[model samples]
Target: MKNRTAVIDLGTNTFNLIIAEKNEGALNELVHLEEGVKLGEGGINKGNIQEAAFLRGMQMMKHFSGLLKKYEVSNYKAIATSAIRNAKNGPDFIKQVKVQTGIVIESINGQKEAEYIYGGVKSSGALSDKTSLILDIGGGSVECILCNHSELFWKESFEIGAARLMDIFHKEDPIPSEKITELNRYLEEKLEPLFEQCKIFKPHNLIGSAGAFDTFVEMIETEKGNDVDLRELKTYLFDSIAFAEITDWLCTSSHEQRINRKSIIPLRVDMIVTASILTGFIIEKLGVKEIGMSAYSMKEGILSKLIR
Candidate 1:
């Protein structure tokens, strides 16, 4: 049998597993699984993991562990991001997972998370020699990595992610302007200190590394034209007008409406509003003309490390 590796990424919103093996010098997937855990649903401000959230996470872990055993994938690594990093009872949750699922989840820091994200982008064979800025907005945090000419330069992680922001400001359905204002204030507070430090990076090229970013790119491209090929290539280049239009449409859309209109599932619909705002702000602040998308992330990072 061919050797295989499994990488599990436990995020605040979902637990994802990528099982693959090297073939012809490339990673080929054998199985991929994603379970919506929403581990950070209500676990941030109070700095605690709620019982319901904990159970959801545990159930997902149990399901993943079963998949691993059934697939007989012995080589594996599991890492938890923002959710675990923030919760006061995070350790307890990790311990419980290990005991219940036989999977030890590593609560990785932002720097390591950035490294994995970089690996994922690099492996995709699309990164060029430009000031590429990679933004990964997860359930509990946002990670920013800057690279010049495919060389790593600087990186930062903010405690601002889709789910976290949703819990923070988008509490009401069809969020109001006042809430948006409050959200911006919160983001500004966190971003202000990083401005001076971010100056050195000089990143003009924009690349977003997450489902939210990818989804936005797809949405804009589809709306502009029914051309799938054209959409895939240039979806990242969301202009100011297009960004505003999409944001306005999504804000007024009920979760069900967004889900049905574009096949956006219920799990993701909740974060659509916050994600749009975040993506728009990132593009505006960086003055980026285009934003790139990559399917690679922490899961790719874990596998790369294991292979090395």
Candidate 2:
């Protein structure tokens, strides 16, 4: 507890907690946990946290507080992202969370969120000398960073997260072809800014940071019967062909089918389809030829800052 530090990322769809400490001159992670609290489940698009979700968030904070105590973590930071920042009642919710669990929530805007995401991806060593586009798809927003190994060139956070998309375009069980078409069309319009940046940077490698990317890496590994211990690696290389195939499968699968898959977590079962569609859209529209997955993301990025 003396030297250890922890960071919590309160995303729209999930709450992530990571505890880490430096050992023998190297940083090591003690624990990383993600809880599907769905804080913005019923009222995200409406710019509010429903009564039930508000109460639910309080419970999760108390639970997370217990974990922090169990791990003897005294130094910790809790970051609230799109869900809380964009919601009309976000500040009130944050206040209640502090009062309930003694955890102060630092809410951040989209731009700052994108910057943190860049830092997280940079730590993974996924960015190369050449240029890479990093995409982090959360529940309330999607962050796209255009950068490379040495520096981050540009970044923007768009409010088209998987959960947001689910609320907008999820009209059928399997998502009809027309609905897919409509969703893609809508995304094309909203992501124009990112596409413009891509043109200037001409990034060929698309790096996905945490969340759905983690699931993709595991799902692909499981598909190939390769039991690669993800903990040992900072980044996982993705074959474009394999990724495309998986994207197609994911976009067409039903909730029941997705729920049965061990790689697809219960929290992501309903939103993965939209997330996959968004990733696929980016890969195709931006002409990205290579894909890489970073196991580190916002929480990991902030943990570094906390330790500093």
Candidate 3:
């Protein structure tokens, strides 16, 4: 049997698993699964993992562990991000998971997270000779990396992720206008360094990493009545106007309305509004002319390291 490896991404809003194996110098994924555990539901900004949220995370862990055993993974690695890394009880929760499941999860720092996001975006075949600013919108943090196919210029991670934004500003279902303005201003202040780097690099192409971007791709395909399986491509360059329209629709949608969309993932329905605002802020502020989506993200980045 091929040496199958499983990589787990333990995020604030979701837990994703991918099982893959190397074959003749190429990496082939065998299975992929995502669970909406909402590990930060009640306590992201509060700096603690609530009992309910902790239970949800633990349940997902057991589910993933079961799958790992069934697949008989030859190797496995789990990386924990924002929620687990930032929570006051994060270490305790990690210890429990290790004792119960025998799986050790490493909580990565912001700088290292940004590097992994860059690696995944690079493998997605999104960057051209022209530089690209890559954004990975996570539940508890957003990672920004400025790079091209051949060089890396700048990168940073911000704690202003969608879950945190939703916790802070999403009081109204559709999100009030003033809240949107406030969120933009807050982003401007927190992400001034990213703005400065964009000015220096002058990268017009904005490549968004998978997660929220995957939802964007599905929504676009649904709007056009296209049946294309987006998973087939590592990268897709979106039509800027279509993307802008979708962003507006998402921002104006109420919770009930967003939940009804066939294309929007249930886990993302509540945060996509915040996520759209964040994406729109960057596009407008940086004069971004091109928008692209990479099908791969940090999980693939970790897998790349293993196979290499």
Candidate 4:
């Protein structure tokens, strides 16, 4: 097995990279990089990747390329999901990435993405043998997987995500009740089939990974206090305070405000609401009260493949 491997997740909203090494059956994180590309910010609405957004992504890749060279990374894999999958020029974009940075970004479908999330969760040692539902919300899509004893019973991905939802239904500041209603209706319609599929699985617990769950942990550790466990995050009530605080903070803040705020930026903050909403709904709809957060996901999957 390769001792060092790098995994890059070219996400719709953020491009993330992790350089790690595996030895003695343990994987250790060595390097991490992320940038807000907002690749899917308006692509879902326009059905094409705009020049500005495409250029932003290119610049981010170029920067990442420099970092990879600096670290002398030899075995690395980069994959893009959702946004690139939906883009009309996604093929051209991937070709351009290879030409520009020498990093080939493979476009993966939703089911495959869910499989990677499942791989990451199973490695976390937090999952139980009983039925568990894994929900991973990205910038362009959400994936839900039901598993027991590390085996997947069902999996589904939805087009709803942080940046996509924010662009589609989140026009009003602090998000008006009417907008929330419309969003819920849309989610219900889309999630109903998956919910029905989940009914057969009857998951004993729900596990959340990536995006909003990451922000929730950041908020709790930074705002609530230190010594807070991931379980405390599951106790979140999604009250008006959390909604208003997060929404108001995301809507009114600019780059300068986030520079010194000592919190995860507003871009990540923007997705937290949608993440929380989905989380809140999953708990109520599935009747599972406990949700565990695993910070690892597609990156780990990539590493697993490379190391093996």
lDDT values, one for every candidate: 0.76, 0.88, 0.90, 0.74
lDDT of 4 by residue, 152-248 (tens): 8898888887678878776655667687778778888989977898778888777767567666556645776654444223323333355446544
* Clashing pairs in model 4, backbone N/Cα/C closer than 3 A: none
Using all chains and alpha carbons, the TM-scores for the candidates as numbered come to 0.90, 0.96, 0.97, 0.86
lDDT of 3 at 99: 86
The collision pairs in model 1 are: none
| Root-mean-square deviation (CA) per prediction | 2.8, 1.3, 1.2, 4.2
lDDT of 2 at 222: 91
Where does candidate 2 clash, by residue pair?
none
lDDT by residue for model 1 (139-181), tens: 7888888885458887888888888788888878778889888
Question: Which digits, one per residue and each the tens of the lDDT, describe model 2 over residues 135-246?
Answer: 9999999999988878889989999999889998996889998999999999999999988888888997899998898889888999998775666777999888889888
Error of 3 at 207 (Å): 0.5
Q: Estimate the overall C-alpha local distance difference test score of candidate 2.
A: 0.88
Candidate 3 structure quality by residue, lDDT tens digits, 1-308: 45889899999999999999787877787888888999999899999999999998888888888888888888888999999999999999899899888889999999998888888888778888898999999999999999998888998999999999999999898899999999999999999999998889998699999888888989998988976565687899899999999999999999999898989989999898999999999999988889999998898888888777
Worst 10 residues of 4 by lDDT: 231-240
lDDT, residue 111, candidate 4: 92
Q: How close is candidate 4 to the true structure, as a TM-score?
A: 0.86
